[model samples]
Target: MGRLCKLHIQNDFKEFYTPQVTEGGVVCITRCDARHKTPLRCVYGSCSMTRAGPECECSDRAAFWYQDQVCRSRISKVGVAVGVPVAILVLVTIVFAIVLLRSQRQKEEYRNNLRSRSELYDSDDGNWDAPQGFAVGNPAATWEDMETPSTSYINLERVDTSRNIHIRRPTVVR
Candidate 1:
């Protein structure tokens, strides 16, 4: 137990022990692994510590954290193929609907002219038959009777513009 303590942990002398070379208790920014796990060893307070150890600390632990990073496509190749055709189909359907609407609009004036002439002839003949089997949707079985006339008259105002007056608002109390 009389072995001279040639080594010490600088800024930390709380523990005292004799350590062999393998028991690397050298003063360094990083902790050194000692074979006997007794911490650093040195000869006569020499500032001979090198920062790096002979063998790399990270070597043994590398396999546990190894990652095989590779680039991945956001959309699958098959999905891209299918989606392009579907998008084209929707665009074609929209164009067809637009063309149909335009054709109908172009014939609107002719249709209206025919309707007015036919209506005039219908009125002259005094025939109320829904023209040529046109199914005017179903009529209601009952209807409301007029209880009162829709419009009424109310007296408006007397012109009292004799003097200017300021109005005060009533204050509310909680």
Candidate 2:
């Protein structure tokens, strides 16, 4: 029976072998073949048999990933779809904030310049009186006095209708 079992084990059951027989009976040692294994089905991927056991070879297509021995995870796709727009929005917001801060700084600098100019023009007597044309609050104080150019009328020559009349030249030489 042992010889018949050994022949059967070698020729028929390539994946199984009876290593030792104890009081319990025959000890069958099973080789790992992922395709025949019932527990490691690898539903979404192909199975590869290794010394450590069966390993799943997941698909390499985009937006897919292997997790828990399966390749059906969509977290990568969902994360990308939601993350890109959020990233762009954050970048635009940062740019807008920078632009707003720069404009505000420029305005403050302009105001400081105006204050300095006013201080420079202030009288030493502490009176509100400024130079005649140097008043800071007056809108027209900076206008230069100048005379407007006079408008001139042009005279046009009148055309005579008699000068436009066509006259026939003498056909015969005088």
Candidate 3:
């Protein structure tokens, strides 16, 4: 009975001894090999012993890498590669759209300003007519009255034809 009691006490202490103690106190209770087994399987990773006892070393696959402690959450490198350019393209498109809308608005404003100015200047009610005196051919005139004289003589007596003028002729190069 005494030996059985000692064994039970030792077995009870064994449970406490299995846990590792660090500066932050007790950490993992199970060994790395046991933690890697059936019930406590580390998905997408393998268990390894560290200073904190057992830890999961998550595998980095071709297109994705594990991000969380459990190795269940993944961050895709391929997704980032594709998503970044698409985001930039969307941003550029939005900027171009905004610029185009602003340009159109400015042009419309300019046209409206021009229309308002023109309307201000010409405020008449559209019934304006030229005076009868200013009308074409109101005063009957012969076709010969509109004809210009073919010969016009200049007063050459007042002209200064005696002024000396120099003309340079290019010499031919042999």
lDDT of 2 by residue, 121-146 (tens): 46432223333322223232333553
Candidate 1, position 115, lDDT:
92
Ordering by lDDT: 3, 2, 1
What TM-score would each prediction reach against the true structure?
0.27, 0.38, 0.43
lDDT values of the candidates? 0.42, 0.55, 0.57
Name the candidate, 1 or 2, with the larger lDDT value: 2
Q: Candidate 3's C-alpha lDDT?
A: 0.57
lDDT of 3 by residue, 1-174 (tens): 234334443443333224445587544344443532233457778865555545677887777877776577888999999999999999999999999999999999999999976653341322212322111221222244454334333334544576776999999999
How does model 3 score by TM-score? 0.43
Least accurate 10 contiguous residues by lDDT in model 1: 65-74
Ranked by TM-score, top first: 3, 2, 1
Compute the lDDT of residue 123 as modeled in candidate 3: 15
